[model samples]
Target: MGEEAAHRVHSRLDVLLAERGMTLVELSEKVGLSVVNLSVLKNDRAKAIRFSTLTAICDALGCAVGELLEVQGEP
Candidate 1:
């Protein structure tokens, strides 16, 4: 068998927020984050997220992190 390869995955935060009828601003307010920071996440431009921020987002969105992220083959 061929060796398995590692790959990077991405999130669909923008789409999810749209489906939930939520804007970045609104989510930011609810999650106690700045709109600018939320926009970075929404636009897939954030390099990393803190645990506290993740918890706040999950709590405000009523969703598990798994629902926000996915795995796929590397680019």
Candidate 2:
């Protein structure tokens, strides 16, 4: 079997939130996700995210998935 690729994915949730003048609590209410879960994502510590959650966040923030997540350069 081939080994999976190693890549670091980071979230721009904080930036987007700031740009939109929205708080994490507001986003949580809109997306129905807890602040702790969103914080993990915002801090780029989350290992996984559900498609539904992604869609909800995008919808709530009026951003595309590409705008929310970015792949970090090789380290």
Candidate 3:
């Protein structure tokens, strides 16, 4: 696999936000997180996330962890 393919984990925050008709600013407020931090995750640029942060985001979005993140691989 190529180097890019090696990174299979992807964030689905954008999709979830869109489905809920929410914006990053709104999520930041609800989750008590900075917009900059959330943007990192939403754009899939974050290398890691704290459990508390994840839980907060999940609660705000009304989504499971699995729904917020996904693994994609070549068939």
C-alpha local distance difference test of each model: 0.76, 0.93, 0.92
Instruction: State every prediction's TM-score relative to the real structure.
Output: 0.77, 0.89, 0.87
Error of 2 at 45 (Å): 0.6
Runs in model 3 lying further than 4 Å from the true structure: 1-5
> Which pairs, if any, clash in model 3?
none
Error of 1 at 41 (Å): 1.0
With candidate 3 superimposed using the best TM-score fit, by how many Å does residue 33's alpha carbon deviate from the native?
0.9
lDDT by residue for model 2 (1-75), tens = 222246478799999999999999999999999999999999988889999999999999999999999998675
Clashing pairs in model 1, backbone N/Cα/C closer than 3 A? none
Question: Candidate 1: minimum summed lDDT over ten consecutive residues — where?
Answer: 1-10
Error of 3 at 20 (Å): 0.5
Candidate 1 Cα errors over 4 Å, as ranges:
1-7
Clashes of each: 0, 0, 0
